[model samples]
Target: MAIELKEYIVAFIDLLGFSAMVQHDCERPKKEHRYIKVLYTIHLKTKELKKTIIGLEITQFSDSVVLAIPYSQENYKKVVDVISNYQYDLLNDGILCRGGASYGKHFSTEDFLFSNGMIDAYKIESTIALTPRVIISKELIDLVYPASELSKNEHLILESDGLYFINYMKNGNADDSWKAICKAIPDELSENPSIRSKHIWLIDYYNHQFPESKRKDNHRFVSPDA
Candidate 1:
């Protein structure tokens, strides 16, 4: 006989810039130290939120966390609220989040266990750019009205499938966070011959993702949330 299973909501929460943070730390490893500390804090906060918010079970991976929650009306709101709150708190620390939430079915059989409907959720999530925000599938939007608590940037939009993805970027309150980041880099390394090559690569990445106008206005767009 096949084992019974139930529908569920899968929440994918991915941390942004873990590898970049480490790779760029050669000049000043202390900066990386600070980044790791912030990550740990975020982890603890999410775990606490899971316990406080009913019907949610939080699981963590190397640079991400996936939460499987009971599929229900109230549970959906809880998930959104928790994530929004999480992002809001991290903004001050210069850390942002990219995440997706969708309801699906988790199957359990005699010889196998698997999930369905999560594929759509992931598809919707893929459309979100590197910003702090939540992306919800069309099915989820139809079920509950999204709150206007967070503003959407270029990465936020409604897909053809009617799924709505919102990218939230906020200004970080950390003192000289960006400046401190730059200061940590040694001038010798910054002026290295290979630095030009890396800058070119960075430019290519930005150009591919952002329009020339947005790229030129670096002051305003350097950080989406800011």
Candidate 2:
């Protein structure tokens, strides 16, 4: 069978600390099955978003989710909108994720997906997206015209590393998300120091983006040397 290959904007996302969620499912009581509920909510939201956004194709397995759309300025905005909203909602639910969005040739079906775009997206998520954020590729950025458009500025934040990522809290409703982080960070901070550093990176990003918020100071973590 001949496949219809076309350019696509693909976002590959992975849930952070997913194994811990799976572990808690079995070890915790039924009423306390937090991860299950969160996963179910994400499932429903993703379903609705797919319906709302025409041409958006999705594939999920275990901890990872892939969202793709036909490459076009309109479709690119649509896909970015989906990721921004999804990331914001996840942070509200105390679930952080990392992802990479890029554009390349792709083809996908219910049971199979073959795409260089997927490879690029996943590589970004795994290697480039070193923290809980969705990093957009330089290639993808070039495709979006008006370079550094103000409207786009609300969603994209340029990092010191020269990568751009979705600014999930730029709309200024970070209070709930701030509260969620307060609850989630303590546990991760107590575990692996590396994981703790990742959480701190997020906190630093959050504080840098929303400096006016009073909660910023409380969110800070003192360095071990300090």
Candidate achieving the largest lDDT: 2
Q: Write the per-residue lDDT of candidate 1 for residues 99-196, one digit (tens) a residue.
A: 77777886533344356644545554556423344677657666655456223434345434444554222222233333322332333334444443
Give the candidate number with the greatest TM-score. 2
Q: Report how far off residue 53 is in candidate 1 (Å).
A: 1.4
The per-prediction CA RMSD against the true structure, in angstroms, equals: 9.0, 2.6
The per-residue C-alpha lDDT of model 2 at residue 6 equals 91
Point out where model 2 deviates above 4 Å: 146-152, 214-226
Q: Summarize candidate 2's per-residue lDDT along 1-226 as a digit string, tens digits.
A: 7799899999999989899989999898898887888887887776677885888998888889999889998888777878888887787777889999999999998899989999999999998897898999888897785774934577788888988999877644658657867755774355576577678877888788767764544345578888
Per-candidate TM vs. native? 0.59, 0.89
* Worst-scoring 10-residue span by lDDT in model 2: 212-221
What's the CA error at residue 116 for candidate 1, in Å? 2.8
